[model samples]
Target: MIDTSSFQGKKAAYYTLGCKLNFSETSTFGKMLQDIGVVAAREGEKADLCIINTCSVTDVADHKCRQAIRRMVRNNPGAFVVVTGCYAQLNPQTISCFDGVDLVLGSNEKANLLQFLSEKWSGMSSDAGRNHLHEHFSVKTKDIKTFVPSCSRGNRTRYFLKVQDGCDYFCTYCTIPYARGFSRNPTIASLVEQVEEAVADGGKEIVITGVNIGDFGKTTGESFFGLVKALDSIEGVKRYRISSLEPDLISDELIEYCGRSRSFMPHFHIPLQSGSDSVLKLMHRHYDTALFAEKVRHIKSVMPDAFIGVDVMVGCRGETPEFFEETYNFIDSLDVTQLHVFPYSERPNTSALSIPYIVDDDTKKERCHRLLELSDRKTMAFYNRFIGKEADVLLEKASYGKAMHGFTANYVRVELPVSESLPEYDNSIRKLLLGDFNHDKTALKATVI
Candidate 1:
């Protein structure tokens, strides 16, 4: 066993990049340190330890991870730096080569971070050189199988519950499976217990996050729909939003349940990496354009005002000009609210590297810009549809001396101006009328009913 007293009175700083799952995991790491008497470092205060959770979805994400590591080390000056997450799992040696990186933990090892810290906390050195990281620090991606549960509110009004982890799908041009390992998840009963705990801690909103949340039954025999049904039965959770799910895994029964359920919001986020059937075939995607469009049509058939977000990738290995045009036309016809468009980046050890006809950088930039513009138009149209409608908004705490902001059940951003007549809106649900766009046009202005 590790000694807990070694961590007492130590101040630590945390830096997290990437998805909501990474943020949820970092928050759990903070709670683990706090239990051992380590406090968070205040502004302008030097810290004794630094924890960085990184992402490796794209080459740009990897670059940002390295930048964050160096900046944290420079700011903390003699702190024990620990790096983990997808980047650390895939490229531990590259990260260890950087100056002042004390340890690089793997995906499975992140769950036992406190034990690793206890072993190194005594007589620790912050030297830039020397063999501080051992070969045993990271396990091979195939060896990772543990599922660690995390339910925490990290600087947000909504609590993120990590019910699942890892991915089994190995799409061409993707490195997530190699970085996150095979699909796995906890039992429905255990996840329900975690939700109850969050509710006990006064959590009003919960977002179900995971790498492949739709593949929730790989480790356990429970289904994702079973997990959803169980979570909706919890008493104190006023809202629940699903982060993203595969189009093939979104069953008709699940969509119907969310359409009628009391707590499940009328919001959905699905990924359509390429709208062109030929490009999707090259990427080895399970479903094609026809199925994806039908899914969108079905969602709208049940809930007309639902907010649908999509993920699109431009400039894959074999995406030609004709294929790009096909993708644009298909997306322009969808009822999606927003688009998350990103240019494809080459990653090591992926099948896409061998494909012919790679796109040029200039062409990729143009395609990304075009998709983003279409996304803006669709988002504005969706927001305008609800301008005169009444909505029940769950207000969040004010920040930056600005008016309070919140989201409706369908995930529309609403801002309420600060005034004495307004009730204490922090963490309170208020019925309001959606008005015109605010000054910057970021969110819709709202007035209390």
Candidate 2:
């Protein structure tokens, strides 16, 4: 344990990997540190501590965690390093074995990080890394029962709010159910307070996120649609976006209500998983392709301009060549804005690992390539259809090549010229006239009104 008495005027640098959910939790950690008078790590300065929030969605993600830990150890000498989140929860001992990791916090420990620090680091020693991280810090993953709510302030324009967490669906290929706990969420009143706090912090757009957000309030009497409806009533936020949701849980009522909502943005990112019904069944997916397509149809019928993004996984067990084509054709036929294609990776103890048909690395690469190409075509078509139209854009704080960038309600990426007046528009919503495609035709150039 390191001495907290030495923490005066110290700074911490946070490095996070994985989804918006992880960032949300990490930002909360930063806020906790600030409450204790610690500051953010500045440029060219060695941090007093470094926090790494990890992911283990795939085998590659585990390797990335190892590489990140080694980089932190090598670059930031004498800094106390802490590794936590899904990867840490899934394999605490493996992460604890890393030479520089001072603490390995599991799911529940990460939520209440301040208490852990106060108890474990109340001045045992500043030379904490010499001893095993397990000797001073450890937590069991199963003891994590309650939910830990988080809202990500990744920037001023967009805040990723985690209203729900965990998953009840034990899909064959997914380890999310084990890594996170059973599906649960904060009460409607608690979530409304979080949204209000986000808006108070000058947040313009709030992206709703979680591990099965559609399955919200499983332990409570409320519902996901009810949660969104309450958020729609909030006055300060300009727009909101729902993250990846299951198709079956996306009711027609939610789609229709959001279509007419003043605050809800016209963008839906629904995970179809696969277009082949047989493959979906093999993976123990809840909904079939027909249901998924019907959900898309409902959204398109209510809001034709709405941007629909689909998440497709390729190269899972039993997905033969014909099955691949079925998925390709089914997605191609859907009126979606874009595709997020992922190549399936085997996880330990998953049911998919026992299945006989194992896709080769070369085959997985090829299938991933095919879906990515299809995504490029779909995105170009979607953007072209919106050309010369007008939409509201919440100008973000990032830019490239002397131009500012923002996103439309339907998730269109738009760029505008950066000038002396651009700072005034930052984090503010502006009426943008989507005009022409830029050179190489990746993003649309817009004129701010």
Candidate 3:
């Protein structure tokens, strides 16, 4: 075995990009480093090793990854850098060309990082050794064939549990299906045990994470509802939230279970890429506007206070004025809490590039702005409804301006001034009486009852 004594006293720092799923994976690897005696780099200190978890969801996302890599290398010139995740999986050589990068591991390769690092560090300390290390460091993603389970831990109150991995749905505008292989997940038994682990680690809430979470158990001969039902029985976790589910994959049984389950929270993030059936078809999304609206109505009927977040893409090939109008009007009619509006960017190697009639840049911006305005209205309306009601909020330590902040069980963002008794309540939940909106309406101001 290679001697790892040199790694024992070193410092490592991590930077993550993209979704909750990526954050969870980064946290997991950071903890693994901790286990081997490497601690996190202290504030204002350069790390001996730097890890960059990447995303390649869009063209801009790719650019951001490049920028982050360069910035990390510039700051910590001697640090060995490891670049991994979706961007690395899709385009490894591009990341490998960076000056300070010692290794580039793909999605499948990233999981077994300790072994790869051990092989590289077998002796000879200088640039010559590193150059030899670099020669054999490319771990390509032949295919993602298994689920790599992970959970987030730290000072945060909410934990992200990655129950599923990969995606089968090859949407025309998305590169996820290529970066992450087929949709796969662990059995319900495995995930329930992971939920128990998160609770034992003092997590109050758990967010189920994956590329396509709702498609869990397709290979295991189980359903998403079955997994939810299993997790609901875990005693210590206070609440659970679905990261984001494809509209069609969301079943009535799942919604109904959330309505009655004591452990599940009243929040749902369902993606409705386009409200126009024609647009949906072109995007290769599985559901239409009618089905999405029906699902929204069902959730509302069962739990009126539930927060529904929708994801929408503003522009795509063949999205004309008529189709754009259809999406806007459909969203306006829904009883949602907020909208995550994304202006579609043509990704290389995707089916969308060949589609006719590309939406102009100006049109994309206008549509994005209009949807953002609608989002603001929807978010404020959602917060307005709960005014004067008591909300149970899980507090976080991150200072929001001059005050502390947290999210209520219904997912309402609330702000309050820090108290002398605040330290005792970090990462803990407390009940508060909701007051009116704050001056800017970004979050509701609440008082402890």
Where is model 2 poorest over a 10-residue stretch in terms of lDDT?
132-141
For candidate 1, the 10 contiguous residues with the lowest summed lDDT are: 127-136
- Write down the RMSD of all candidates, one decimal each: 1.7, 2.3, 2.2
Who wins the TM-score comparison?
Answer: 1
lDDT of each: 0.89, 0.83, 0.83
227-321 in candidate 2: lDDT tens per residue? 99999899898888998889889998898899899988889999988999989999999999989989999999999989999898989999999
What are the TM-scores, per candidate, against the unseen true structure?
0.97, 0.95, 0.94
| Candidate with the larger TM-score of 1 and 3 | 1
Runs in model 1 with CA error above 4 Å? 123-136, 420-423
Candidates, ranked, TM-score: 1, 2, 3
Supply candidate 2's per-residue lDDT for 164: 84
- Per-residue C-alpha lDDT of model 1 across residues 28-94, encoded as one tens digit per residue: 9999889889999998888888999999999999999999999998897778889999999999888
**Model 2: CA > 4 A from native:** 1-6, 124-132, 135-142, 398-401, 419-421
Model 1 shows how many backbone clashes?
A: 0
